[model samples]
Target chain A: MYAKEKTGGELSVGGPSVRGMTNAIVVERLVKRFGATTALDGVDLTVAEGSVLGLLGPNGAGKTTVVRVLATLLVADGGRVEVAGLDVGRHADQVRAAIGLTGQYAAVDEYLTGFENLEMVGRLYRLGKRESRKRAGELLERFDLIDAANRPAKTYSGGMRRRLDIAASLINRPRVLFLDEPTTGLDPRSRLAMWEFIAELADGGTTILLTTQYLEEADRLADRMVVIDRGRVIARGTSDELKAQVGGQRLEFTVTDAAVLPRMVERLRPLGVDDPVVDEQARRLSLPVSGGAEVLAEALRLLDGDTSRIFDVGLRRPDLDDVFLALTGRAAEEVASDDDTTAEPAMTGGAR
Target chain B: MSSLAATLSDSVVITKRNLIKVKRVPDLIVFATLSPIMFVLLFRYVFGGAIGGLPPGVSYAEFLLPGIFAQTIVLGSTTTGASIAEDLQKGLIDRFRSLPMARSAVLVGRTVADLGLNAISIVVMGLTGLVVGWRINSSVGEAVTGFLVLLLFAYAVSWLMALVGLLVRTPEVVNNASFIVIFPLTFVANTFVPLESFPSVLRTFAEWNPVSAVVQAARDLFGNTSPLAPVPDAWSLQHPVLYTLIWVVLILAVFVPLSVRGYGRAAGR
Candidate 1:
């Protein structure tokens, strides 16, 4: 209840306040098993106050399980979990009070009006009637649901329902917020709106712990990220740091003629093109290089400076996807075996 | 506010949510209301006046009303399991689990909501009984006591069903399982005819049956003095009340823990 207040306009991005650097969530060696399957295996994570920590992992990689344990919904068999300095097991109610959780799916009651849903959550947090109504109104307006506030949630669109669900979790203004794949099924535009809303919450000094399969989402919003694989924390750092760990950029190009492949390869051999691979059918050439832009320019110069006929040329830094693949030995989308619904939807689109 | 107040507030919110759900799907309430009414009408007209050897002044309406009361509560209580199973299947229970409300509020709210719906159906059926010449001859206090007993029975039964719902993975399984288990239990009792009219072994069991005791207690309170003249000893009539009480306590004792344990397992899953 004594969370620090944010200072500045909505768009004014500022660093986290250093005075309240206390950890909002602390999970150490947490392990949970469902019968024979180990859902979480010695996972350790800490979320600092006012910072957004993204838990990036493939499906079935225990991201949701970790959130559940920290939220006091599921008990860990082998480790300690604390929220806002309260132990999750011993002080579950306090932990619950201190944290808000938005699961993968929107969990608001479809039958209740949006206003009723917010009011219900407020009352559950023990707010007085007037206070609950005021808070509900504030949330409705914040989520842009004020006009449809009186309508049953069943009538709301997918994005509207998601916003309502997120609003419901904020009824008590929890110190820590856990969003588990919050933007999974939303459309691109809706996902961006939800991301902005989450960014605003973080800017408002709420410690947010988000789990998402979208690499771009993690890259965009996470101040720091932890990549988990097979129930273990495989990598942890800021997005750039993790990407740096996976090594240099990738250089890709498409030549106009397949007959020029050998000559181009020979010309670019001196530019430190390691493991150059050519697709004759697509007339594409790809190679990993240390300095992306410099290497591309040099390779172009070596090709007789004929850049006009080049079909495609690009340089890309190592993305979260590459980092994930490098650490886990498999693509994120491929690891989600249980959910046949491909991760492509979340990847190709926005965070949706 | 006190902890009890906090718990009550949480339960009230959940109850409000469930009530909204019932409102959205009006068919649920419609079916709940019509089922008991149809049962009363069908039993009163089709089976009444043909059970032969009725007491001198006893009408079929008077004889069947008590049994129908028990029948209605028992039937209505099964919805507890069905609704919970549906919620679980739809991830509604999982959503509730993620909330910061009291843990017991989820099941308690559901049972309470079902009890409210059951009471409405019971009252409607009672009116139908009155229209057919059946009446409560007892004092207001006795009538209230009888109603409380029926409600308590329904609550306990709902908790038992809630446990079943929690344990089962699928809604269809829960629906089929509860009905399968409850139908024979309700039918074997003296709901349709007196135990004396049954075969010798069944008659003996039915005399000791708790359903029979509930019917007899309702009859005694309603001033429908037994025409058999030589009613079984006072202990036999009192056994139903005692048996039903024991059942209520036993169910709470077993199912409350079962429900919690089932919830714990589900959360782990």
Candidate 2:
């Protein structure tokens, strides 16, 4: 059966089972609903034991719902899910023991100190008192929160609090770690720092399933991605594969003046392989082309003598953004921004 | 270890986490104490003379101290609802669920920690009652029993609050809604006035109310009962301890499991 190829033999490594197991997470035809709303609709996903599977979707698309279900925090109405080789529905405690989850918002207790939060998590994991304290100290140091360890979590900045939250999840060094928009509200620098920390964990062979609206995050850390919209998987592939599906390259340029855009478009259209798209605000125009470099160079040659100056010019292949647009029929960022306005601003239903 | 052992240990850990919050954020406890003190001072000086139908020869403060103890603890239990709702909003309950700990730990810990806060409020209010001429005329043994009954009843009600807290979305909603429910419960009883003063139909409901039974039980135990206090013909007031214990058992039997179920749903969602 297909299940035989997925669940592997027992663990050999000490932390995270390293490369021993083949599938850390698997969901088939999963279904969930809240009142009249079906939050998850027959979705399937599989993450090899040590790889990262990014659950890429807009907010309220039920990415958190799927994560919650896999983490044994939600009961699926239909189908089967196994995490760390244990059935999520039947062996929920075992599944919970094998996984760690850092939610969309940091879930650390604000009244507890950073050290206290980690230690409490460890103690709940059944680590003895001494060991719990030891692990708490180690994790705080690893997260670079040692200095603030004695202060309540409420005193930490957003990024510091997020780090402490992630550290609490790792107190037991779970085999499968789920991060729900781990960098949602951070500055660009903190986002990069978080990416590096997540990458380091991935390098240690910890399986990760992350949901994100930031395409750049998926592109940066995910080995494979499943794009879901409105509780359904619309596309799934490696970043490049998704990009390639919405195929072809575009010749793009920004002219000095908005009025000269039509002239530039006219010059590049004939050399173009397909229709051109213009940006009035950016004073930019792009044309799909068959010949890679040759067409780009040829387009520049034709526009060389034009009176209007060119601020920027380049030939570009599609990224995950284009793939998301092609599959969802909407921009990823737009759907994400819509969430900020439409959904409850804080963690609520489906957070678990 | 066994499942029960694990649950107990997990509960202790979570209880410690909650107790730490009380220590760090003193406002909830402060308000818990302050409100009861306000009630004592108001009832003793302001309302004491205006409240007619009180029996002669007994000071209002002496007649009313036991009722205050019972009422304070019940109102104080709302802290359970507020604190639990705050945890639900903060997503900390979800975090606890993700661990391998006992599913019952979060609810158990919350009620227990709130019990501690209730105990503190009771002590502070007791001291305030003393300063205001409220005295325990009975022996230490009976007073101890009185306080135990009060704490047990409050603990049971705290579980009911736990269920509400888990069912609600925010601490503010829990605070507001619980007051709407708890106010009538405490006020309609023999807490602020004598049973004879209540209209006949309302008097029946007030006498039988679990809040009244506990208050009556505490009044008898503390030797605080006087001619000024309500003397009802109902069996509930005649056997206040037994009646209060029945309510305690009844509330526990229903709300304990319901709160646990609600907690599971809260975490999963």
lDDT of prediction 2: 0.83
- Per-residue lDDT of A188-295 in model 2, one digit per residue for the tens? 678888999999999999999998875668888998888888888887777776667677777777777889888888777788777888989978787878766777
**How accurate locally is residue B177 in candidate 1, as Cα lDDT from 0 to 100?**
87
DockQ of each: 0.48, 0.78
> Clashing pairs in model 1?
none
B73-112: candidate 1 lDDT, tens digit per residue: 8778888887787777765676667666677888889999
lDDT of 1 by residue, A51-139 (tens): 89899887888898898888777888998777888888998877777778787778777788999988987877777788989999999
Using TM-score, give the best candidate's number. 2
lDDT of 1 at B117: 89
Docking class of 2: medium
- The lowest-lDDT stretch of 10 consecutive residues in candidate 2 chain B is B223-232
Q: Which stretches of candidate 1 lie over 4 Å from their true place?
A: A1-20, A251-272, A276-321, A340-343, A346-352, B53-56, B90-95, B98-100, B200-209, B229-238, B260-269
- What are the TM-scores, per candidate, against the unseen true structure? 0.86, 0.90
